[model samples]
Target: MSPADTGASTTVGARLPASPDSPTDSRMAPGGPGYRRMSLALFLAGVATFALLYSTQALLPLISGEFGVAAGEASWTVAAATGGLALFVLPMSALSERYGRRTVMTASLAVAVAVGVLVPFAPSIGALVVLRAVQGAALAGLPASATAYLAEEVRPRALVTAIGLFVAGNSVGGMSGRVITGWVAQEWGWRVAVGVIGALAVACAVAFRLLLPAPRHFTPGSLRPRVLLGTVRDHLANPLLRRLYAIGALFMTVFGGVYTVIGYRLTEQPFGLPQGVVGSIFLVYLVGTVSASTAGRLVGRLGRRGALYLAGGTTAAGLLLSLGDRLALVLLGLVLITAGFFAGHAVASSAVSRTATTGRAQASALYQSAYYVGSSAGSTVGALAFHSGGWAGTVGVGLLAVLGVVGITLCGTRAARVAARREPVPAH
Candidate 1:
């Protein structure tokens, strides 16, 4: 179908089908063959990218101990990858626009797999950081391209369900990767662990290539100064997008910071947890599975703003709960945080994807770039809180970041009301 046919001249947002009548719904409609195929492909892609991206994080403590680096310095291993991913956000977004989502996402995962192999071989911390940074850059491809593919292909009626699955896959992959790699490092060594994660990513990349169908729709987008500036300005002009971006960044920032502090605190602590137990905390990510799917249902019933408010409050409450030192309380907190994060991410990401009239990948890339930037920035900064006031201070920072999301939620709700009143129903 041509852009003209789909109402691309304006933001149609995304409309999903009510029910998939056949296998084709996974492919061409919701719950049809196309969707199932793409969802599987996306699941594979998520597993591969996350396994490779976070494999280093699981081994950071070991890396620091082995290399005789301080805890703060050791974190660069993870930070380097995030920084690389951030720098390429717009470029990769443009690359997908110019080439295609299928090609770009496949290549992105492929390159990340290759880069994942090198981290285990770095002879020095400096070399590891460089490798990690390069790995981060390579990791940028999947996020923007994948999000765009979903936004474009999923029937608007089914869009929320599809996005929920993709985000769930991401959360699952991230949790599993950390646990898997951390365990492997504990049993064998960091090198072997890293190598295994890379190998898995390579395998999944191949699966993604085989499974993901060719896009039903795509349009070339330019990177020239005028074109790029216009596109950026167009997205920035959306009052809702700006607020979504802010909320996304702050949500991840606080959540990422919370996770970072918990790991370090558990490593020491009045609790004195081992790495294995620390890894087990990620098991609580199971809650995210439910929340991701539930959020989709919520969006249909609650509309956009109502869902966000629920997500924000869930996140804030979760962060507060985890502040307790009791092991049971901490695990419960992790569950709450996991559920809250997925819910918020699902709603905001879908909203961002919908808000754009064109270059949806670019829109998604910007959102994710900002999202992970928060992740990297939050996790890194949280370390300082650990150094200063310990876990309580760290929780304080995380909670404060959550407050930012609350403010964004309120602003977004108000603006959306105004826009709806003025414009009535959207073009789609």
Candidate 2:
């Protein structure tokens, strides 16, 4: 960040107005009802998007059985959305710069809702995948601005809390969507159950638009290829940011891969669970939600290095537990894996935001884009393994991925420590 640029944004941020209603906010001169509204909108969105998006996951076996597609092909129903989101994130970020975050995000939510409502009507598996792909792309904007909204609107002290709440929404949404779909599939049918979740998502989207406050500090984003590439290079060049991206990739890849096949696993052999039973498994996300909140305290005590190493090791343990044939072991393993992912992601996301104080939004955006890309890749690879090698193969790859995360953790911690030492102390 150049001095001129720093002065420009800081001057604007400093000029932010306060509401007359809240003397506390007026005293601190941070955000207003608008920022709070934005946060609320984002939180609700997390509930809707994840619920609607991953609802298909628990239904993977149903999709396979009904559509007569192979496990890998059915897996595309979920993977396609992730893949589309990966592609759309950057472009959506750019769109927000031009049209503004709230506008782009609201529109995106509407489109996603439309896609969800249309899902039950899809005549064939191919059509459903295509609609899912588009819906995934549409969802890209909501998550993209979600971070930018927080970073730009709230006080620095309050930003992490807001982000944490939004992520918590993701946990709740994912769990409910799967459970609802699974339960409904057991009683009604997969189409009606999934479609109802989608309808609820649409309602949530409308509420989001109505509730979210418009941006007060947003300026048009730069569309210049030169500037875009420069921003990309700047974030990528930062050692800590680079490592965080790598960690995000590794965790999501392995985590996504492992969970992607769980339905397949349960549907086979000793388990042979129904879709409702498979969906109930997502109740395990409750552990992940609890851990994500609790993990916040760890960053204050151990710092990123110790915290991340512990998390990576935890992730590995989770995968190892999944290798057991017993239902108890499988559930326990998933709980650990979800816990580790939330913890690791929380640490990594915080590290990246702190890496660049001025370009925080862009840095966070880059980080999230990599995160989803990892999800897409992981789901795809997990599908292939589930198809050919089965549970053991998926477990093998997941642990192997965690080993790489361990290496990244050691290397990154060493670098951050070196940088800390190199940073000069100012005279008191």
RMSD in order of candidates? 4.1, 3.8
What are the per-residue Cα lDDT tens digits for candidate 1 across 289-398?
67886777998788777887788777777777877878888788778777888898888887777667676876888898888888788768876777788877777887
The TM-score between candidate 1 and the true structure equals 0.91
Poorly placed runs, candidate 2 (over 4 Å): 1-39, 421-428
- Per lDDT, the best of the predicted structures is 2
Which 10 consecutive positions of candidate 2 have the poorest summed lDDT?
A: 3-12
Residue by residue across 312-334, what tens digits does model 2's lDDT show? Answer: 98999999998898999999999
TM-score for each prediction? 0.91, 0.90
Worst 10 residues of 1 by lDDT: 4-13
